[model samples]
Target: MKFFPINKEEMNKLGWKECDFIFVTGDAYVDHPSFGHAVITRLLESLGFKVGVIPQPNWRTIDDFTKLGKPRVAFLVSSGNIDSMVNHYTVNKKRRNTDVYSPGGKAGLRPDRADIVYCNKIREAYKDVPIILGGIEASLRRFAHYDYWDDKVRNSILVDSNANLLVFGMGEKQIIEIANLIAFGKNILDLKDIRGTCYITKDIEGLKDYIEMPSFEEVKSDKLQYNLAFKIQYQEQDAIKGKTLVQKHGNLYIVQNPPAFPLSQEELDFVYSLPYIRTYHPIYKKDGGIPALKEVEFSITSHRGCYGGCSFCAIHFHQGRVIQNRSKKSIIDEAVKLTTLPNFKGYIHDVGGPTANFRNPSCKMQIEHGVCKNRQCMHPTPCPNLEVNHDEYLDILQEIRKLPRVKKVFIRSGIRYDYLIYDKNTKFFEELVKHHISGQLKVAPEHVNDEVLFCMGKPSKKVYERFEKKYHELNKKLNLKQYLVPYLMSSHPGSDLSAAVELAEYIRDLGYNPEQVQDFYPTPGSLSTTIYYTGVNPITGKKVYVPKDPEEKKMQRALLQYRDPKNYELVYKALVKSGRTDLIGYSKKCLIAPKKIRR
Candidate 1:
């Protein structure tokens, strides 16, 4: 019910002379469970460990890192909930104007590559202290990942940050086990076997238990080897039957254990029930609070993990593909608790996780046999084993809507429409249209071209079309005018100028100008990014075209919003460049007129 210690004064109030762990972060302190730092620190505290936080420390100097003194256990480092480079720059690599994670939405509060910077600063403050890295930045970059900003493959972050250990995925289970080992007077090197943790060793001796990946030298120099290496590592991410993986970086070995098991409903409920203040620390009250907290303060994360394996997303590599949910009673408990907050205004902004429509594993078979490593649950075609149902999700929403002060409950975390359409029960779809949608229902069909969709690990555009039709029918039956807003992307790895034109035409047929267009950003650890860098699919090893030219990338993005008067020039150029000068005349079918507009 209270915030954790952030400074020496708060530590004094708690009567703590020294801490067990000092958590260093790249974000302003927001004591909400949604924030990685709060969840990890709270779970540690729940287990009777003293933890302190140094949020957005002055990494330029060692003074701020030593403020908490030395921790008896280890120093936990995270680059907030998002990667630092993605946080600081946009798709065009332009410096972003604001950072929601920082107080007052200010930019430049945290340095670039925050995990490495913060860990290095901690090392300067106290040499030989164990540093454990987690959070999105470290988790996805835990392997030899392609850094889009650097335009090359970099070694595992363990090598760069020099951290003693790295914990990927949701760290509740791993952190507990790690703390237990440390409490027993075990050395950091002795704690390598814990699931979800990665460690470095000078020699690969005694690592025969792990599945060895292609050596760093081979993967770095040969694109085919890199592709094969990623596919093997991707398959072993399953918590159940996965073998530990080992990869060589020069003479050193980076060994990663299988991911920790997903939290059971009872266990997940306990973590959410921890003492979360549900907002930014009051110390940031004067600077207008952290912008990130404003988005989720009223919202509830009812679950974790995602089944929708969009190639551009890092969720599977981090949260895994297995779905984990909080118990119904537990979710209702959180919803009721939300009504007590001072800012409550009759709305529960959202109630979902990675994929809102997903509440359970795709099928019962997933429990006995781990999710298919080679096949997706619902991409290309829905696997026969894929059981598409949404009754449990609908029930939870109906219960939350009945809460006294809760007037409306919206699902902004996004629903997998393809899966909804695959379900035989139209009841969930009907209820979603009638109750859940807030004027517009947002769904990501990413692109219209099936080739691009295949490369992105998304379902074909036809699936989205079917879902769109069903959505319209349901809204009509309910006498509502709800809209299905499709989230579209341009310049994805497989998309060339011709593919971009198809998407623009699809948007034209839909008769709506997208308020925003997502230019495919090749972030690290994404399947799409792998192809963008290597021009080969790690899974299929098929060559794919990538949009790397800046001008070509600009033209693809411009075509998505060709209807926008400002995009006229780029649209015209894209049409001409693609050898589609036929679309550049003053005809009804033409995207733009040959004559230049004032814009």
Candidate 2:
């Protein structure tokens, strides 16, 4: 038996190879951590199955499928993400809170492809390949969901991706079970017993009956119900298994597995323990661009998850609200490994995570008091979950810098200014400047408008200004060239022309013309997107402004990168039309005005 990975180029190059299984996908890029396809493919190879990876296949026609030949066992279908449509829509809809992807420029593409289109392409390509859909897109969209883009709920991707099976959440365990069952010669029909997967069928009435029986919605919405559901799903303790629902319709068999096991502390440890050979994009190989691997720097994960529940963000949904951390020793060892790499540079570290400055568990105290109710501490408001301590991080920083090969350490991740400002001592700040490799630190203030910032779960503009002032004062006293380069977002919900102009004014006052400005893309499963669709805060239930017009969105986005004269003219007209003349001559405000008038 052999395996085939079906993508256009690979299919053409290795046409019609006899294989036991085929893996099909639609991602041009590879080595993404979240996409377990790469690992699963490697694991199959290790098991002695002839496996092939089709990277970024054109799903436009059936010709693309015929090229891969046929497989003996099954065709594993994944689009890297759970559902391309969900990924595309959510990413496209998120407002540009930062200009990180600016170098790519405006490609003028839809944020995401709808699932129906992807499913149609799959149905056209491989009529009988036993398609299996898994990933965040498939997981969340497995059932009806609130679609922010369309402003209504939509059907599951299982109905759309045309796959034989849909696996949700982290696919490691489910994929492994799938491969093992196939290896044992159990047909897809006989393997519905496995947990942690969902499949589709024509028996819509049965499925509806099964779902309506107890209403997972009731269990899913309330915290206590959600936790009990999560425990039932993860723990899989037989005592909790209330009932099993099996629905069969026409050649399709839909099996919804009991939730798989949660990652125990040991399991979580194993995940981080995997040999993470971080590599740079081959495009950056020439200049030794991956600074950490080159020995010039080391990359460290400070913490994970963000408390700021931005509606368009997937981090909370995927990584969860609770922050998990590595022991200081684990981080220090990674730093030690950097020194051993060939042609090592003297830089000890560049530390960061989803949000740097967040160290340890955010709710240690809450756990101690046994009062922690929510998974996320920072949400709603910073909880008394854990002691907010920068010292643990500070100690790790100090330790890594002491290494002989380490000349300096840097914090490259965008610092949460609000968190840092709360630190009582300026020792961390002082050490940061004294040990700088680059004369700059990057931060994301996102937006200056109070309404926008509040919506983003960020500190007010005043807080960021205070941090900025302190940052500059420290740099001056230390006689360092290091400066704070802030990131800003544009065209988010609640940000009208006036709000955008206010942000532009703030940017100009900072004396920087950022080349990139991000327009918001609403990712699925974010609180922000929920608010975007409802025009009211999901948490607060207050009426809010959401810019619905395309022209208005474009003008708001232009406020960030108003270097081009055409953009300036358009923005100027927009601002004038909106009657925000008070922002016209402010240097920051001038981003949308003609250059000469500002001068």
Q: Could you tell me the lDDT of residue 183 within candidate 1?
A: 73
Q: State every prediction's TM-score relative to the real structure.
A: 0.98, 0.71
Model 2, global lDDT: 0.58
Clashing pairs in 1: none
lDDT of 2 by residue, 180-200 (tens): 787787777556656667766
Clashes of each: 0, 40
Residue 542 error, candidate 2, Å: 2.7
Candidate 1 residue-wise lDDT, 138-227, digit = tens:
999988988889887888999999899999999999999999899779998788789999999887677656798887888888888888
The root-mean-square deviation over C-alpha atoms between each candidate and the true structure, in angstroms, is 1.6, 7.5
lDDT by candidate, in order shown: 0.89, 0.58
Clashes of 1: 0
